[model samples]
Target: MMASNIELEQFYSREVEFPSPLLASHIKTAEREVHTLLAGMRSILRKNIDPSIEELIVQTGSSYEGLKVKGKMELDFMIVLFHPKFIFIPVTSDYSGYCKIKFQQEQLQSEMQSSKKWTSSSPPHSFQYDFTSDGYLIPSEIYKWFQSLADKAVNQNKSKFVRKFVGNLPARTLILNISPGVDICVDLVPAICIDRDLYVVAKPLKTSPDPHLWRLSLSVFEKKILSQHQSSCHLKALKILKYLREHDTRLEETSQFASGICSYHLKTASLHQLAQRPDTPEGLLEHLHQLMDFLIECMQRRELNHFFIGNPSSLAEKAKVPSNITHGERCLNLFDDKFVKESTLNQARERLVKIKGSLPAIIQQHSGPVAYSCNIY
Candidate 1:
C-alpha cells in the first residue's frame, strides 16, 4: 500500500527538510574552508605565473555551482583559467552536450612554472601533453597542487587549520577533511571561459561513453533560477522522493528502475512541476502525484525524456545545444530491457503497480484529492 496523506505529512515533517537546519552548520563550515583553500591556491598561482587576478577566476557565488539537496551538503566551484592560447568548442552528442577546451603546450608549461617551488609536489598533470590528444588543463590535474597551495596559505599568516586539506593522495575529486568527523567533498572543476559568462567543462560524465568530453554546465544560471522561484514545497517534494528511493526496499533495493533513477531526476521533476503550478502546503500531495505519475510512465516505457524545463542557460547556448532525444536512448540502454524474460524492468513495473494501487488509501486524507491515473502495463 502507498503512504497515506497523514503518513506522508508526518514523514515529510520528520524526514523531508528544506534548507535543513541540522546541516546548516556543516554547510557553512565547508564553504568557509573552500574559500580559504581557493584563496591559498590563488596566492601561489600569482607568485608562480604572477598573472593579474583577472586571468584566473573563481566562480562560486550563488549563480555558480552548489547543490540544493537537503540530504548532503555538496559545494562546487569552477576554476576558470583564461589564456589566449586556449580554444573552446561546444559539441552535441546523443546523450548530452559538452564544450571542448583545447590548448597548446608550447607556452603553458614554461609560462606557468615561473615559480619553481610550487611544481615540486604535483608537476601539473600534463599527461595530456604526452599524448597527441589535444587537451586543455584538466581540473583533476590542477587539484594536485593543493599541498603547495595550502603551504602558501600557512606561511602567509592564515590559519594553520588549512594544513589538513593538503598532503592527502589527491583523489579524482578532492575530499577535504574539514574537521573531526565533518568533511566535505569538493569538485574543483577546470574549465575555460568560452564567452564572458559561458564556460565548457570536462567533468567526467558517467552516463556517456565519452567520459572526458567537455560539457556545458548551466550551473550558474540554474542556481539563479532556483533562487528566483524555489518554494518550500519544491524542496520538500524532492526530499520525500529521495527518501523513498533511499529507504523503501522495493524502490531502493529490489527495483531495476532504481538504478536508472537518480536524485537529479527527482529534483528536476519538482522544478518542472513547480514551474507549471507553484506548490503550496495544501497542494503538496498533488505535486507528488504528478511526479510519481511521470516517474512511473518513464520507468514503464524505459525512457524518460530529460526536461530542459526552465533551463537557465543563455538562448545562445541553447541555440547551439541539440534536443535531449539524442541522449535519451543512450540513457535508456543502461537498464535491463523492459520485456525480456524475467526482466528487471518487468519486476520494477510490478512494484510501481503496487505503489499506484496504494495511493488511493494513501492520499485519502487530502480533501478531494485529484484522481491520479497511471499506465501500469
Candidate 2:
C-alpha cells in the first residue's frame, strides 16, 4: 500500500482529459433533467400516500479508504438519498439519481471505448454534488412519495424494479472496482454530516476485516523509519502535526503530545548519516521500531489532532529530544534557538468519524503500527 515517489509520479503523469466545459455543461443540463425526473417521480409517489408523512433529507456517501472484495477493487458510491430513513432504498431522491447515473455510465463507457484509450476510470455514474447549480437535495416533505414508491415496487414483487425504483439501502460505503475486472458494490445507507456542510465527512457502516486507515499514518511511519537520514520528510511530519494541533482543538491535548515528540524525534533522527550500519536486518528493525513508536504516538493523538494544542511551545520543548541522546541527557543544549510558528493562515482539516451515533469502526486503536516505512530521503 506504500507509494514510492516514482509510483506517485506515475499515477499522476497520465493525461487525464476531462470533458470540455461545453460537454460537461450539456451533461450538467442532462443531470438537471435527471434530477427533475427524480423529483417528479417522488412527487407522484407522494400523491398516492397519506399527506402526513414529513420531510426527506438527502445526502451522499464518500470512501475515505480503499475497499477490497475477493481480492479485487470496486467503485465507491457517492450516495444521494433522502433522510428520516425508509426500508430498502430509504432515501427518496435516489430513485431518479439511480437511473440517470446509470444512463451516464453507459454513455461514458461508449465514449471511452470509442477513443481507444484503455483507462481505468469508471463510467460517469459517480458524480459530486456540484453537477447542477441549486440542484443539491434539501430536507423536504417528500416521505409520503418515497413510501409509495416502496409500496409499488413491493406490491408487484419486482426485485429489479424495486432495486431500481426503491434503490439500494443507505450504506456506509459504496465500493467500486475502478480497476478493470472487479465488480462494483453500491451501498444504500443513511449519511451523517460532520462539522458544517463543507468538508471532512464520514459514513460508518458494517465494514469488512480491513479498515482503510488514513494516509497520514503512512506519512508518520515513513518519517520515523527515515530517522537516520537528513531528509525534509522528517520536517514535513512535524509541520503536519503542528498544523493539526494549531487548527484542531476538539480532542485532549495529551493525545497530540506524542505526535509532537515524534516530530522532534524524526527531525533529530533524519540528521544522522545514511547507511551508518549498512545492509543489516538488525539495523533495519531498529529504524522500523523507531518509526512504529512515532506512528503509535500519532494514532494515540489521532483524536487530539481534531483540536488545537494549547501552549504549543511548551509541548514542542517537551518533545524536543535528540535521537542519540540517552534518556536523562540534555539534547538541545548546543543548538541555536528557533521558534517554529504558523507562517501563514492555518489550513488544517478535521479528521473524525461521520457515523450517526458513534465513532467509525476504523477507530485509531486498531490501525497497524507496523506498516513498511518508505525511505523518502
Candidate 3:
C-alpha cells in the first residue's frame, strides 16, 4: 500500500524538517561562533604566518543551503586565496572537473619591472615555495603551507568556547568541539576564485593521477540556484533524500566507491528535476516520488551531468555567467568511473527501491496525534 499524503506529511513534519526555533536560536548561535573563530584564525594567519596572503572566507554546503536535516549541523568554509598572480590551466579531457594552476611569474615580473616595483623580496612565500620549478602550483605543497598556518591559528585562538580543535590534513577538515557531545565538522578548503562562478580548490581525489590538479567548485552558484528555485516542497523533499542517504546502511556498504552518491550528487539530481518541472505550490509527496524516480533512472543509466556544465540556462533570470567559462560545450558526468562504480550504482538503485517500498510502513509507524509545527524556513 502506498503511503497516504497525510501520513507522508506527518512523517516529514515530525522527522525531516529542522525545527525552526532551534535553527534560529541554536544553529544561528553556533554559526556566529564559527564565523568568529574563522575571523580570529584569518587574523593570526595574516599577522603571524603569511603577511602577504589574504583570505576571503565563504560558507558553503548543505547547512548554508538550508537543506540540512535534523541532527547534522556541520558547516563548510572556503578560504579563498586573494592572489591574482596565478593562472588557471584547464586539464585534459581525462580530468574533466579539474584544472592545473601556475604562478604568473613572467607577467608579474614584467608588470613590476615596468612600474619599478620589482624588488628582491617582492614575491611572497606562496610564489616562492608552493610552486614547482616549472612554475606549476603543487597542490600538496600549498596544502601543507595552509595546514601549518591553520594549526598555528587554532593553537593561538583564545576563544574559550571552542573546547577542542582537531585538524584533518588529508580530508582538509577541521573539527571543533563547541560543547559536550556536540562537535561541528568544518571543512576549511583552500580555493582560488577563477571567476565569479568558477573556483578551483587544492582538494584532489584520492585516485587522481596528478595530485597537483585542483578540483572545480561551484558552491556559490549552487547556493544561488537553490535559493532562487527551491520551493517549500522542493526543499522538504531534498532534506528527506539527504536524510535517507545519511542513514541508509546499504549505501554505507558501498563506501568503497570513490565518489558514491555525495550530498552534492543528490542536490544535482534535484536541480535537474526542478529544471524539467518547475516547482509548484503543493505536491510534496509527488515531488518526492518523482525525485526518487529520477535518481533511480540516473543510476540505472549511470549518467548524471553536472547541472551548470552543459546547461547555460540553469541559472536564474538575474544570474549572469562570466565570459571566461563557456557552458554547453564541456559536460561533466557525476557518475563517471572516478565518481561511482557499477556495483555501487546497482546497490544504490536497490537501496533506493527498498526505501521507496518501506516509506508507507515507515510513515504509518510514525503516524500519531503529533502537533504540526511549521518550522522549515
Report the lDDT tens digits of candidate 3 across residue range 228-300.
Answer: 7545577678787776675454334453222367888888988877777774655778878888889889988
Question: Top lDDT: which candidate number?
Answer: 3
Q: Candidate 2: count the clashes.
A: 28
Q: Predict model 1's lDDT versus the native.
A: 0.48
The ten-residue window of minimal lDDT in model 3 covers 368-377
Residue 333 alpha-carbon offset, candidate 2, angstroms:
35
Distance from true location, Cα of 12 in model 2, Å: 9.8
Return the TM-score for each candidate structure: 0.62, 0.24, 0.81
Better by TM-score, candidate 2 or 1: 1
**Each prediction's Cα lDDT score?**
0.48, 0.25, 0.66
How far does residue 339 in candidate 3 sit from its true spot (Å)?
1.2
Clashing pairs for predicted structure model 3, backbone only: none
lDDT by residue for model 1 (323-369), tens: 33233223322222422333655565566566556654433322321
lDDT of 2 by residue, 67-172 (tens): 0101111122221332322212111121111110111112434654575434457432212111211222211112223334434534444221112222322222
